[model samples]
Target: MNLFIGLLNMAIEKDNDRALYLVQKAEVLAEIELFYLLPHQRRWRSWFPEVIYCRVDVEKTRIYIKEAIKKGKWNMDDWPEMKHKILKLLSIDDAIIDLAV
Candidate 1:
């Protein structure tokens, strides 16, 4: 609870109104995540603390990465490698194991 409050305070300080309001909502969710969910049973495992908790389908995650790369104007050919890194960040158990490094 304290951690969530502190995080909310920091977010509110640094972000704009919309982001601040979202952080307030996130704080409520964080409270539930921290107290209601047990350690092993928690979904997503706090994999990306900077990311808000939500249902992120693997395909959508891939698409988002591709879109972000395009937006950033980076010309990288390693689609497979980038996909693997995004999946790993999400802590998805089915992510390609051989790509681990």
Candidate 2:
């Protein structure tokens, strides 16, 4: 969860480079299977797999992404493909429809 929080912080800071860096770091942590081994960190560890896969629910992911966007942590031009990937991961199209009501 610390990794997720770090990602969120990176996004909120509009630091795409930093965000990517943190993501990479988190990925490494996830891959090593050490993300769940910390004491008193079971809650986050339980969700480690989903975080690695970016398979978290759209609503939750959206909050972080939206926050990042709002804070200017990401720039479309700098990460065009990544932007789309993030949107797709969060099912932005479906979120749009859901918000249309």
TM-score of predicted structure 2: 0.35
lDDT to native, each model: 0.59, 0.62
Instruction: Give one digit per residue, the lDDT tens place, for model 2 in 1-101.
Output: 58766766666567555546657767666654554465445446564545544345668778877766666665567768877887887766535423433
Error of 2 at 32 (Å): 10
Instruction: List CA RMSD, all candidates.
Output: 10.7, 11.1
lDDT tens per residue, model 1, 23-78:
58776777777888777655665542556745546787666555555465333345
Q: Which stretches of candidate 2 lie over 4 Å from their true place?
A: 1-54, 88-101
All candidates: TM-score? 0.27, 0.35
Worst 10-residue lDDT window, candidate 1: 92-101
Model 1 lDDT, full chain set: 0.59
